[model samples]
Target: MIKPVKGFSRLSKKEKIEWLAGTYLKDQPDDVETLKQYWNEDTRLQQLHDEFTENTLSNFYLPFGLAPNFRINDRLFAVPMTIEESSVIAAASKAAKFWLDRGGFKATVINTVKKGQVHFTYKGDKKKLQNYFDKIKPVLLESVKPITANMEKRGGGVLSIDLRDKTDELENYYQLHCRFDTKDSMGANFINSCLEKFADVFEAEAQRYEEFTAEEANLEIIMSILSNYVPECLVRAEVSCPVSELSEDTEMSGEEFAEKFLQAIKIAEIEPYRAVTHNKGIMNGIDAVVLATGNDFRAVEAGIHAYASKDGKYSSLTHASIENGEFKFWLEIPLALGTVGGLTSLHPLVKLALDILQKPSAIELMKIVAVAGLAQNFAAVRSLITTGIQQGHMKMHLMNILNQHKATKEEKAKIVDFFQHNTVTHSSVVEQLEKMRKG
Candidate 1:
């Protein structure tokens, strides 16, 4: 039986790896070398990767790819994506190319509002606290002027602040709910800085008010932070064409293909199980772009999933329809993205990705990100209704299977070409590789 180890974190990297190998990889002599093999070749680059998060492990690599020919709002952009899963970039590029001549994607930023909250407890009187809030609203705004001045010069800052009574949810729980226009940055820091300042101002001003009783004057601050649920920060991306233009590119008519595609989306709409996976497929594209641009993909993902369930039940994020001989597919998602702050300018790859995108503003990035999701879902649905998802997905996954089996370079090339026409499966690839070895 394995026993617990002490002072593990105090050990050097080499020592830590040595202990781990002795304890866990006793049967596999070469596993330690395999782990070390993935370390970055450049010492400086490795240092940067180590500092990205805690515990300085070797870098884990994901393929960073470019999906080109994306025409959004008459401007072409080559979107960058970083993800481990294959076929996503291929599918997105295919959809972009498919729609390149058919008006491509159209995206609009409906709102750029972000949310933050300052929670506190005031126990004496609701009306009195309300009156106190009314009197100090302007002071609250003025207190954050120092923080907001720079953001204001850049055309972004706090938009509104309101006192929210949530005593019904919990005893004496009142909040100073606020909204902001973050402009071109994912203004978590900016919003949070302002909120913390607001809390300080509210507390100090309440102490100065003569109408406030001793109990009401001493408001206990629970917390102040920005919210990840920004339903108002919305962007809509859509593609439309005549139903007759939708075809299987083989023999199926356009109308028939459109019907099948709409049915696939409809099934995802009402079915919770399917909708979850369906929305995840869309996120595959959205997250890839979000990471490449150095924004918070996890927050965007949480807010989007919450929006998906806003109508009482989780459903599809992308929708499709045929109206008046037109086939339209679209997605409206809340994405709080930044093009100027966080890792955008600090990370090298993020800088390159943003520059490659022509350094769009926050709203422009929102539209582009939304288009990525829409395009990804359309490609997935197109595959689902026509050739089936496995055919393309397995084909893309074939090389990964080959690599896992330790196929030689020459063997990989030959097998890749062979699988182009033939079926691709784990067992099938293994059999083919074995046959080639014999030959």
Candidate 2:
């Protein structure tokens, strides 16, 4: 049996990999070489990657691709995406090219407010707590001025602070709910720093208040952190054209395709089972761009899903309708993105991705990200309504299947050509490969 490791983090990168390989990959001795193969040849660049997180073993890579012909707000762009999935980039690209002729996508930033909270417990009189909050609110704002000064100068800073009582939900529970505008950066650290300061000052003031008893004055701070559910930091992206224009290449009439597409969206909106997968398809596009830009895709995912269920039911993020001979599709999602901080400045590829996007502001990034999602959904639904999803998805996945079988160059060409006129399935590809090898 393998024993637990101690001081694993203190181990050098080489030693850490040796220990991991010996402890877990003993049967596959060649795995050590496999890990080393992925390391950057340049020592300086490899060291930069190692410092990004703890227990640096080796780099795990995902393909960084570009989907071209995305015309958002009348500006053309070749949006960058980083993901491992096969068909996502293809779907997004196809949708972008299709819409490019129909005036492309229109996007808008609805708002950019973020939130944080300081939770504490105090068995104090409600009226006294409210009065104390009102009195100290100004002082609380004043205390964080040094931290917010730079953000303020950039036209972003603390927006407001309010005291919330949760005594009925949990005894002795209260919180300081705060809002902020961090401008170009995601501002997680900035918001969290300001929140911790607020907590310190709030606790200090409670102790000195004359109205509070000793127990009430001793407010216990649970935590101070920024919230990932930023419902107010939202953006909207949309595309619309006459129903007649939607049938450019499809076999169905534009009106028929529009009706079918609307019904598919209606199913997603009303059925939780379909909505989960439907929204996942949208995120396939959203997350690829979010990761490429080096912003927090996980945070964006959490906030967007919460927003989807804001009305108390998980539903579709993208909406579609056929309105008076016009076919419209759009999505409004909460995205707390940054163009100036975290990995955006540090990661080389992230910087490249930003440049590819024309170095947009935070709001601009939100709109672009939202449009990517809407475009992805449009492509997916279009496929589902006409040719069915698997015809395109399986075709895109054919290359991955070929690689897995370790087909040679000549064999890959033959197999790819064959699949163009034939169905693509794992068993069928293996059977075809086996036949080709035997001959």
Output the number of the TM-score-best candidate.
2
- Give model 1 RMSD, 1 decimal: 2.2
TM-score of the candidate numbered 2? 0.99
The digit string of per-residue lDDT tens for model 2 on 41-120 reads: 99998999999998988999999999999999999999999999989999999999999989999999989999999999
Candidate 1 per-residue lDDT over residues 241-354, each given as its tens digit: 998888847367998988888998999999999999999999999999999999999999999999999999999999999999999999999999999878887778999999
Q: What 10-residue stretch in candidate 2 is worst by lDDT?
A: 122-131
Count of residue pairs whose backbone atoms collide, per candidate: 0, 0
Give the root-mean-square deviation of each candidate in angstroms. Answer: 2.2, 0.8
User: What local lDDT does model 1 show for residue 316?
Assistant: 97
Reference-based TM-score of each model:
0.93, 0.99
For candidate 1, give the lDDT of residue 156: 85
The local distance difference test score of each candidate is 0.92, 0.94
Model 2: how large is the Cα RMSD against the reference?
Answer: 0.8
Over 4 Å off, model 1: 1-36
> What's model 2's lDDT at 147?
100
